[model samples]
Target: MVCDALDLDNEEAEEEMYKLTRSFVNPHRNFEIPTTNQVFKMETGKNDVSLFPGQIVTVQIMPEVIQVSKKAIPVHIPISSPIRIILHPMFHQMTYSKAVQYLKDKSNGSYVVKPTPKGFGYIAITYIVEKDKAGVSVGLRLEVEGCKYIYSDLGELIVQYVEPKARRAEDLMAHAKFKSSVENLNSLEMNPNHSSYGFCFDYEMP
Candidate 1:
């Protein structure tokens, strides 16, 4: 029987493989799983196996010997750049309240992108909508889908205001409208007096 051929006792192997695949797909993850490819040399005191693209192999995880070499391995996979709503010299790990406070006195249209405190691969874009006697700040939720960023109705409303035909968040990033807006916002001098002026936020799920 097929079940007889399988080594059911070694369940960690399957989990390790899944982790490896996840790490390959998203390099930003905290842990890494080694592959039998040239990019990762397996020093398991056995004959090394060469793997071609799209090839599959059963990996046996040796927890004791699973150590990556000090040599750097060049990853050929194309990873997307972090979504930066505004170009500012700030730390990418600030809280939501701090982010709001940073933009409290800024002019309308000023914005900041930060990782959502709720996590789960979601991000928040906080921007100033009204900067009159009473300032108004709006936070929009954005999700990372593979290499692209996407948002729902609220994001659509803002994107449509700049580009009526825009669909994906990448569209807004590439559009001249938002590019100009980012440049204008970046050009504005940051208020050094503000306590949270140098703090920002960015995060990736593992």
Candidate 2:
């Protein structure tokens, strides 16, 4: 007599097999279970992790789990494998001159965040300090050191001082009113009727 069907008689084994087969068929339906090796790799900065909205993952912060609510760029942080930073909507990739020109006609305090053209991981805050005047605009270098953002030009700690505190660039922008020369840039979605509509552009991650 053959014994191939013997295991099928066990209810627990049958249920487990069914679940495995279903997970294989629908990979997305399967829970995200990072292997020990995967966690090690992420901790060592050897790999990057991708996370989707509403997905929960276990992290090394006292071994706790967190759920993401929106799409974000995976940024490596010391305490976590892949932390997310929501870049401001006004963030763009433009040269200093272009950024200055974009803010030239706008009111003072109008600003935009752009990547420092010199290198990666460095950001610049280009704003119109004085409208309709020579040297009307200025670009301040913003650096992310570990979890804190350093604004060397301001000489004050960027992480502190901001009301309610700000962890990321987007948060800082929300607390501070650095209006965009291109109207509607403050909103999540663009509005067609805002002035300088042509300057509104989508932010492309570098």
Best by TM-score: 2
lDDT of 1 by residue, 6-100 (tens): 12223344554455545544657543444454243221122225332222324343334455679987989989645434333332456678877
Which pairs of residues collide in model 2? none
Q: Compare the candidates by lDDT and give the number of the best one.
A: 1
TM-score of each: 0.24, 0.26
- Give candidate 1 misplaced runs (Cα > 4 Å): 1-91, 131-206
Report lDDT (Cα) of residue 102, candidate 1.
86
lDDT of 2 by residue, 1-206 (tens): 10011122233554544454334235485334443333211111111243322222212312224555898889987683332232557666677788887877776445666656454545555554333222212234443444355445432332242212222334434543445343445563455454432222223421
- In candidate 1 the C-alpha lDDT for residue 59 amounts to 34
lDDT of 2 at 27: 46
